[model samples]
Target chain A: MKYYVCLMVVFLFSVQIQAQKVAVFDSYSDLEKAVLSDENTTYVVNFWATWCLPCVKELPYFEQLNSANKNLKVVLISLDFKNQYETKLLPFLKENNIKSEVVLLTDKDYNTWLSVVDKDWSGSIPATLVISKRKKKFVEKMFSDYEELNQYVNSIIN
Target chain B: MKKISVLLLFVAFIVTAAFTSIAPTPYKIGDVATDFKLKSVDGKMYSMSYYKKAKGFIVVFTCNHCPFAKKYEDRINDLAKNYKSQGYILLAINPNDPEVEPDDSYELMQQRAKEKGFVFPYLLDEGQKIYPQYGATKTPHVFLLDKNRVVKYIGAIDDNVDSAAEVKVKYLENAIAALENGKNPSPEMTKAIGCSIKSKK
Candidate 1:
């Protein structure tokens, strides 16, 4: 009976995670600590927003990368306006069915923190950072398609 | 044989162009900015030399469409109006390609300048030649240049983009003040967060 109950709890917990709303992050350090906690794990972190059309276009490619590679985790860090979280970001996420671990960063002081992420980064949306135990890559541009993103992510993961 | 090699080179160019999307290394502090005779909203060509008596310029890369640019519009106007009297004139340039962003067309630029009561010349980086020289990465980017065209500062208008009232560090203004006092602006170059200057894909 205990074994059955434990299985039920595990299933329920996963279901909740599967339908998880975006995790809100009030600061950049909190985000970095949470996302980069596991050094052995590879992460494909993308900075994007709903208002940015190019970001929206390339989002599905990241989603495709997520479902295709279970070991490689993809985190979508949203920079949407805090006020429009309910009106725009949440609905857009639900409509598109974005399944990756998504987080919203409301940190206002960008210039000071951007260099910490990547010296070359200009804080533009659709920027990507791929990290693994052996290597890392930061690109301040969008991936044109799934093949482009998939190949780039795989190159880092391997 | 020559034709075959030419065909191979063309194919290689196409593949690389589609696959790679990296920002060019923009101007660093102390780099001398190039002068251009871009067309202004007034339908006349103007260059840095036009402001003969000024000590320096606040060249701002902005547009009508970007939300971030909209937020800084009035603040930018204030900067231009206030700083011009202090010997630093502001030059607003819309560097985005009109084909990629319809709202950034020349006609719309004129309309925006009128609507916002732009005190400075709002110019177009025709054929997108000038912005690349400065290595501007996004709309609402600023480059504070001395009378000799040396870049003194580069980046955002302030610390807070959402509300000008809440801004703590006025990056551009401080840079202007630094220049007036013959001192280097601390934190000379900073990162910009806005719409990447649109170009033909």
Candidate 2:
């Protein structure tokens, strides 16, 4: 009876850990609406991909920021090719147990919307956009650690 | 008190200098490109002057490892194959520091070229000087130049990176067409999306 109870407990814990639901958006307008829907919360939108090493390395920092802060909304937008949704991205999230809100941005019209994200952006991965109703900060580089990521969150929130 | 003030001033100067040492400006459209002598994977040293009869050059800053660069490798070869006979030589330069990315080392570059059957020159930016001069921020960044070495266009090969078939706009090809017709290329610059070029710490 005790062994059965232990197995059930382990199964429940695994289920909780593997719970990552990803939303897909085909256009920038839909993404913009979702991000701007909340005026009180600052959305920390991170552009990344499964193939980018720096992006994968910094995923935990975003996950920590997501759980610790209440007013900050964290969105991990995957730039992985649309075809890889089933084969690569889903398996990566499941295997790594990424809990943060994930989304697949299927927009192919990059030149039209890259400037909309930031005037200084050169369309590089591991870029970040911290946005609220009153202010916005765009960083076109990787956040080295949790401290640096926390600093960005604090700067935008306060 | 006077010594303390001097010390504070020295500290302020050091901080200011540290923050203000910005990188130099990169070449823009219409700017004359500086010729570089880089060693090719085929074991030949080449400069812009080597292509004596060429009408223009397709200068691409790409490497072997980046998945995005790998995606465009075949297309790059196609460009070289189609244009080499037309006097536009393709010169691919790998700028990633080998110390930072071992996979982008000179040997691998040679191996990739051999596997891909590349007829163009795949060169290594030895001291990592050429990319900064061109202001390339990522792999697969392209700079199209005319015969006089004036930059005609600087950006991506096309709008769609995921699939070659789904592409609606061919930016580089259009720019090359403009140059062929003796006109300034429309939309000379576009954002290139790819992996950041790894630099040594």
Candidate 3:
């Protein structure tokens, strides 16, 4: 009887966890409303994926940036597959203890949204864009340290 | 009976493995290439069919963000200039999601193309539907096609990702040369290095 109850409890818990919400953006308008609404709040949008080694390597800097900058809004968008949200993405986020607001991109076509973010983008990961009311800065290279990321962000904010 | 069942299960596993390993890539050597009508840096339309009469085409999937791709930018330009008159054309495609990677946008692509003096057409694959069709897995992925539009070679430009001196194999050049001479390429495909081609969600 005890074993049966334990088994039932385990199944219930699994169902609850599986039902947890996974972020998916339908359009740029959806993303803008969620994370980019406040013009006064400087936004740092980091594009990354689980399979990308450089992206994984630089994730800590994003975390550090989010924690250190109270005035800035850091959004870490995972480019992993929507189906793998539970299997791959959620575990990664939990393991890293990522504190930034996490969202998953849901656009099926790259061209449609490539220009939506910036006309200069070339569909690369580890790419970052810093947006303020007055100015916007985009960097397509990976950063080795928080200092490099901070320098770029500071340049824009100032 | 038990032993027979075990044997059957092992056979099934082996068959499955073989099937998985032998799956054909989307693009292969000698296949008629599809023309892409994509936007170029100058806001003009560029298509592979425009150069259908060329000796060969070097289609590269590259992006602005990857250090590996950046390292080979000058080399690619050199290749374009050296071979353009010889009926060789270079076509670069950027297939990343703009929302996720705003720097890969068409405007930035134009700026980078002009800034780098790209002799080839830097086209934008806005929807990223074209890359997977070519089985491009990474930035700086090279696909060499002969005049008949057969993919003669697919992979990296060279063996080294960091130092050019350390490059033991010039895969792209070698393949192009072999095709020109009507000879089969020695090392047709090699492992490509650089950023994974960004896929649309």
* Displacement of the residue A157 alpha carbon in candidate 1, Å: 1.7
Docking class of 1: medium
Candidate 3 lDDT tens digits, B119-192 = 88888887776887786766888888877668888767876555577676777888888888889887766553
* Candidate 3 lDDT, A28-61, residue by residue in tens: 5687787777878889998888867679999899
Error of 1 at A45 (Å): 0.6
**Tens-digit lDDT track for model 1 on B1-201?**
999999999999999997786555578888889988999999999899888998999999999988778989999999988988888889999999999889999999999999989888999988998898898878889999999999999999999988888899998888888888999998798775788788896
Docking class of 3: incorrect
The C-alpha local distance difference test score for the whole of candidate 2 amounts to 0.88
> Which of the CAPRI classes, incorrect, acceptable, medium or high, describes model 2?
medium
Clashing residue pairs found in predicted model 1: none
Q: List the DockQ of the predictions in order.
A: 0.57, 0.71, 0.06
Model 2 misplaced stretches (Cα beyond 4 Å): A1-17, B1-11, B18-20
Between prediction 1 and prediction 2, the one with superior lDDT is: 2
